[model samples]
Target chain A: MELFQEVILRTGFLALTWGQLVMWAVGFTLIYLAIRKGFEPLLLLPIGFGILLANIPLTPLMTPGSGLIWRFYHYGLEWEVIPPLIFLGLGAMTDFGPMIANPKTLLLGAAAQVGVYFTFFLALLLKFTVPQAAVIGIIGGADGPTTIYLASKLAPEMMGVCAVAAYSYMAMVPLIQPPVMKLLTTEAERKIVMKSLRPVSKLEKIFFPVVALFVICLIVPDAAPLMAMFMMGNLFRESGVVARLSNAAQNELMNIVTIFLGVSVGATMPAATVLQPKVIFVFILGCAAFMLATATGVLFAKFMNLFLKEKINPLIGAAGVSAVPMAARVVAKLGSEANRKNYLLMHAMGPNVAGVIGTAVAAGMFISVLAK
Target chain B: MVNLESPLSGKILEINMEVGQQVNEDDEVIIIEALKMENPVYCPATGVVKEIKVRIGDQVNEGDILAVIE
Candidate 1:
């Protein structure tokens, strides 16, 4: 009888707390979103599973030194390994042609950073420390790897929340951005049809990554790790002689690092750590950051139209939040809805890709200014 | 002889011209949807559309053969 009672005690039925149950629901919700709703399946799936693993009673998955996930978090994130490697994969897949074709769109990308800076002050007002606020503010940039990179450096405690906020907001771009874009611009501005992008030459494409690498690294050395890897991957693609290497970076290396990044991030949040008022504040601030960023981009584009003879569509400005093709697609959709014949995809892509660099630079600046 | 290939990667949104229909340079023969915008693919040369190998909603990669003309 005593043996049976001891076994029952070890089974976790009575030991499972209400907090862990809530965390399991959170994990399953992510899984459901990934599977049923098709929301970032590659990322959310692993993250959801990792969350489940984290909450299991008596499990050592997140135990200080011996747990499997702890090792991954320690070496991969704390040591500053996985996020930059993911950026390497992203670089290989990215095509700089559209951004190169319309260099002025880079301004829209820079303008979007206004949201990040704005959020920094807001987080500070909420009593988050300087480093914590900087990491939280980066959620506005809407770049996953960059957010994780900064979080791991400035405030490791917030890594999971910041990553979740960044990615979820990114997936919700279609829903979140349209309302803001519509509220900011008129029918005429949205209907404006951008001219087809000029064909970017092979030589120009080749020179872009090199010049950007040199200039950005020289100015913001703190960003060198992520920026260097990103540019090197781009150069590999543009060089045309490293097709095998580029393919591997884009497909294999990207896939591997993504798995680690998702799980490690998810594992950081046990029910105990994340079930707080602070988490809700992070999520709310994240949405605000996105809104501020989107508005800034669109407004900046409108401001630019005041000078140029050829008026660029202000809608493309919202693509500067660095969600890659997703933000650009939302811009294209809005433009199409406004004018059936308008094709703004390529134009939006200019700011879309530039936003990637813009976000990385913003992260670097935060790291330089805030991180001790 | 000429083959009309996809100039960009995207889903086929519409096939504007039927096979055996006459087409000219710059004629919008196919529309591809990418980045949430529909981009028309023009006929590369003036000729009767000899064959159409893609349908609306067919995902295609750049340089994939969509049609042929002679």
Candidate 2:
């Protein structure tokens, strides 16, 4: 009879708690969103599967010393390897041609950072600590690696939820951005097609990452780890002699790190930390941050137009919020709808890529000011 | 031959016309899905599609010929 009771107690069904159940629902929902709705499936799918793994009763998947996921989390994230590696992959694939061709669009990228500060204050008003608020504000930048990097540093406990919020908002960019974009700009402004970007010379392409590395690192030394890897990857692509290294960085190495990064981030959630009331607040604040970023980007472009001789499409400014090609495509759709003649894909890409650098700078600034 | 080139690189979500089908300029004959958004690629000029170089779900880079019109 004692052995029978022990067997019953050992079964996972008897050991299940409300928190685990809740997390399962969350995990399954994320999985459904990824598989059915196709919402950032690359990250969300692994993350959802990891959530299920960590919640299984008595599993050592995330147990500190001996667990499989624990090792991934410890080395890949806590020791700061995965996110920077992801940035390296991004840099390898990035074409800075558009941004290099029209450097003025970089101002639009800088303007989007205003939303991060504004969201930071909002989180502070709602009673989050300075470091906690800083992590929340970066969701506005819409770069998942930067968000995870900042979360890992400023508030490790909040990492899982904050990363989830960032990815969710990123997938929702099309739904959230168009209303604000339409509200702020008239049809004429959207239809006003700017001149095509000048072809950036190969020399300029080779020189960009080098110059940016020197200037940005000098200003924000705290960002050097991520900045260095990013610039290195770009040089590999542009040097025209390292196709093998560039391909590996952007493809094979990238895929391996993405799997580990997703699973490790999801493992951090478990029930104990992620079930807190603060988690919900992270999602709410993240949405507000993203919307504010989009609004500011569009508004800033209109503000810039008051001085420029050749008018720019304000829609492209919203791409400065930086979900990479996703955000740029949204702006492209909006531009074409307003006028079929507008081919804003290449143009919007300038601010879209610039936004990545802008957000990295914001994360570095936060780290410099707040991290001891 | 007038080649109907893709303006953007993306997966061909749908090819609205087949070979030997008549098409007109500005006809939204092919849809390319890039980053989960469906973008309609208009017919570049009026002609019958002599050969369809791409099919649904094929990835085509910018300037890749989707079809040849003559």
In angstroms and one decimal each, the interface RMSD of every candidate reads: 4.7, 3.2
TM-score of chain B of each: 0.95, 0.94
Model 2 CA deviation exceeding 4 Å by range = B1-70
> Candidate 2 lDDT, tens digit per residue, A207-238?
99999999999999888878888988999999
The worst-scoring run of ten residues by lDDT in candidate 2 chain A lies at: A192-201
Cα lDDT tens digits for candidate 2, B1-70:
7888877667999889988998999899898886666778888899898999888889877668888888
Candidate 2 at residue A331, lDDT?
91
In candidate 1, which residue ranges exceed 4 Å CA deviation? B1-14, B19-29, B35-70
Estimate, for each residue in B17-45, the C-alpha lDDT of model 1 and write its tens digit: 88888899878889998865667777889
Cα lDDT tens digits for candidate 1, A135-223 = 88899999999999999989999999899899999899999999999999999999997765677899998899989999999999899
User: Model 1, residue B16: displacement in angstroms?
Assistant: 3.6
| Predicted complex 1: DockQ | 0.24
Candidate 2 CAPRI level: acceptable
In angstroms, how far off is A88's CA in candidate 1? 0.5
